[model samples]
Target: MARGSYGRGVTSTRTDRWLRLDGTTNTRDLGGLPTVDGGTTVRGRVLRSDNLQTLSEVDVRRLVEDLRLREVVDLRSTAEVLLEGRGPLRAVPGVRHRHFTLLPERGHHTDVFAVEEADAPELPAGWAESILPRQVAEDDQEETPAVRSYLGYLAHRPENVVAALRALAGDGSPDGGGATVVHCAAGKDRTGVVVAFALAVAGVPDEEIVADYALTAEVIDDLVAKLASSPTYAEDMQRRDVASHTPRAETMRRLLELLHERHGGPRGWLTVHGFGPGEQDALRARLRDQQPG
Candidate 1:
């Protein structure tokens, strides 16, 4: 919700009003949020969106000039990069772009997820209590990517998450008064999780972060439709997308709950996840002010 007139498109869905790029998927800025403290997450300091694969001339102008975007962090895989075949970012004069597949090594996470996705979504929460567990057990362990992929996602704690954070944390601050935008293909699963951590570092409130996580889906409904039609679509993508939109509000609550139940809070979640002392403080300094606002 970056205030100051993000010119509404000719159409008028509350969702469509937020749409920035037609060809590019899941593009939206994380502005206008009132952080835990009094001040807001400085508008124009950060923008989040999808791939730059299909950025048009107008789209590039808006991104580089209007938004004054300094850097673009693309989280898509090498294979996806080859498939999509990107073009130059329209010579904005000063913008820089870099790619770092968040869950690096496509072999581990994506491979495991492809084998785990089931044909359909899980039963509604309350219904699962009665017989879904038994149904799932009988259906086969391979049918549940959330159980399998999430485990591998967590297991890669040894590699992926920590490495992704390091890359993000090390990126130089926004250049010459411009902001930075980070995104992956869909901008919901891996991108969402990592961006959530980034906002947390920036001192955004937990509620605001959750709201932001949900916001990407609202703005990029078309991408969801496209993914459904994608030739490579599979069960794991279905399961991951299912887990992604699962609760609307439920997933965020659950992540926060798990963090609280085990460690102290989001900070605790990072500590336990193997982000060492120096790394933790550096991230905090980047995201939070020394004095509590």
Candidate 2:
């Protein structure tokens, strides 16, 4: 469907940036962002959303029939998916579902989406442990919990991180229509990191990327409430307030800074992790819009 043709709950905020669904608060098109070369990201090609387990029938229909969803890039851990089960979208025939757990496999599930796994194994030598509690105390706790959690994406699972980006870049889409919806438990961390890398590859400015990340702050309350209402996430959410899990614009800011300064930006990071020129071009093609006549 055309962008404006989306159903009633779709809000007018930020020029149709959000895909407001009754079941999800964080779903939105990763399109129309200004690129470095004076272009815009293609609309309806790439979407980012939260957990799809609670989607209503209407919501699923809208996503399938209207959005032309071609694939789903689920970044949740194995344990989380096993505990929560496949969501409403699992039954859709045309859409492809590819699961790539971004974190290490564990026997028990934790709120990995909201916070870093405290029991996660130590990083290999040379990977910064800036997010660990010991590092936090040594540094006077200068790093916010959110920033540490974001950094952990790099420290703990760089290989899976690269794979997740490849999956989003059309590796999982058979036809390359680009209507891929990527989500995790909260759709803000793993989703955010992968989306950030995708946007950076498309040459979207850091500010715009940060803006998109902060958009989650708009519906955080309702999003948290929805997750809390579900049996899968409610118990864990009760232990913490929504604000602690809320996305802050600054968190993304710091992440981008780290990406540029440490990993040499998205392209550098991807190249180091085994995504070559062909992979990069494919991702760019999926996100960038054609010039108008």
Candidate 3:
């Protein structure tokens, strides 16, 4: 596969994985990635993206008509949904939207997408302090804070994770059936974790999963800038440096390693969390292309 530089010393396989659109910079099809069994993922079966609040009508047509997007597995919090409303896709027929927020519901509205800097006053008190430190102390000392944060998503909300996986699996259909797009605010952290699990279940190698996660780094600046312009994410974006937000391969690599160490890998984690073998097979079948005889 041809490769290209995404700056910041990150180079990704240039397989036309990126889905260029007028609204978002980080949207890409999770297709053509090499799986463990020597088969590649089917194109258009699943997509990972940043926010869709600003998608143009043409963007909608491109996704809804051209891509045949059947479901949107939004990983945003209740506050985000309430603040962003449903966007234009809400009006589109035949498209289903499912919200399975990976954040623990705190009764009051919290900006779950916000950069949980220790001193960010705009964030609810004890937001980062409450969960992050504990997660870091419990996990491997070598794990990056980002890795710990990703684990926190699974630790705090296994039910949501299982639900999101079920949504991705969606009735095993050959011929690369209708697509499902998963997104959060910037499609880096929350979206990356969920998509990583799905791809892992599909038998994509750990390096491939890390590479796919790091692809977001290629457009990290664009994603941050776009979200920074929004009232919803502006404060959080301003609080953190852009470099800190770049999705490093090491971060995801450590995350996958931790999953392996703790839960016996994605399959093990899914099984423990109620996804079970039948559902796992469905998801694998949904995302994997049939190998030739």
- The per-prediction CA RMSD against the true structure, in angstroms, equals 10.8, 8.6, 6.6
Screening candidate 1 with a backbone cut-off below 3 angstroms (N, C-alpha, C), the clashing residue pairs are 117-235, 117-236, 201-287, 202-287
Worst-scoring 10-residue span by lDDT in model 2: 1-10
Give a tens-digit lDDT track for model 3, residues 198-260: 888877777777888888888989999998998777888899999988989889887777678
- A best-first ranking of the candidates according to their TM-score comes to 3, 2, 1
Per-candidate TM-score against the hidden true structure: 0.64, 0.80, 0.85
User: Which 10 successive residues of model 3 have the least lDDT summed?
Assistant: 1-10
**CA lDDT scores, all candidates in order:** 0.52, 0.72, 0.77
Best by lDDT: 3
Worst window of 10 by summed lDDT in candidate 1: 1-10
Candidate 3 clashes: the total is 0
Model 1 TM-score (2 dp): 0.64
* Residue 285 local lDDT, model 1: 40
RMSD of 1: 10.8
